[model samples]
Target: MKKSIEEIQKEIISEFSDLTDWEEKFQYLIELGEELPAYPEEKRTESYLVPGCQSRVWVCPSLENGELQFYADSDTALTKGLIAILIRVFSGHSPKEIANASLEFIDAIGLSKFLSISRRNGLSSMVNMLQNFAKNSGSEI
Candidate 1:
C-alpha cells in the first residue's frame, strides 16, 4: 500500500511546482528541516558522521525486516532538509530498490542548481553515503 520511489519523487516535484522562485522553495525546504524529528545526542558518534560535507551530517541507517530506516540530522538546516528529502524516498524501501533509484528528480526540481557548489558536492556525498549503506547491506545498485 506504500508509494513507490517514483511516486514519492513525483509528489516532491509537485510540491516544488507551486513555488515560482528558488527563494520560496528554499524557505519551504528549511521548513521541512525544522519539522524533522529531534535527533538523540547519544547517536551523534563518529560512526554516523558523514564526511565530505561542509556542514556536519549524522545518519543512523538501520533495517527493519527488509526495509531501510534512515535517521539523520545535520548542523545546517539546508543540509538537514536535503537529507530529509532523501529519507522520504529511500526509507521504508528495500535496499535493492534504493540502490536502483534514479534520483534524477533532484535535477528535475532544479535542486542542485539553487545550491552552492560545495553544497552540491555535499549532497552527492550524502547520496553516496546512503547508497553505500544499501550496498553494504547486500543490495546491488
Candidate 2:
C-alpha cells in the first residue's frame, strides 16, 4: 500500500533526527539533491519556472486516476532537494490535503529551524506554486 502523508512525514522526521546540527541537515539535503533525477533541458522553459523563487524552479502537477502527482526540478542543488522533500510530502495526496497542509508539520520535522531565511521563503514559494497548480487543475488544494 502507498504511504500516507503522515507516515511519510514521520519517516522523514525520524531519518533527519539522527543529525544534531543544521550543517548536517544542510549536507543531508545536498545529498538528497544529488539523488534527484535530472530535469530534461526541454522541460526547463519559462512556462514551468516558478515565480518568486531565487532559483529557477519548474513544477508540474498532474492527476492520474484521481490522485495527484508532482514533477519538479530546480537549478540549485539544495533547492532541488527541497523540491524532493515537497514531493515526498505532497505527491499522491488529494488537492484539499495538499492545500490545507500546515507548515507546522514541516516545523515539527525540524527542517524549518535549520533552513536559511532565503531557503524558507523559497520553500513557501514552492508550496504556493503546487497549491496553484492544484487549484488550476480543479482540485480543492
Each model's lDDT: 0.89, 0.79
lDDT of 1: 0.89
For model 2, the run of ten residues with the poorest summed lDDT: 132-141
Q: lDDT per residue, candidate 1, 43-73, as tens digits?
A: 9999899999999999988888898889999
Q: Estimate the TM-score of every prediction.
A: 0.95, 0.87
Task: Give one digit per residue, the lDDT tens place, for model 2 in 67-88.
Answer: 6888878878889888888887
What residue runs in model 2 are displaced by over 4 Å at the alpha carbon?
A: 139-141
Q: RMSD for each model, in Å, please?
A: 1.4, 1.9
In candidate 1, which residue ranges exceed 4 Å CA deviation? Answer: 139-141
The TM-score between candidate 2 and the true structure equals 0.87
lDDT at position 69, candidate 2: 89
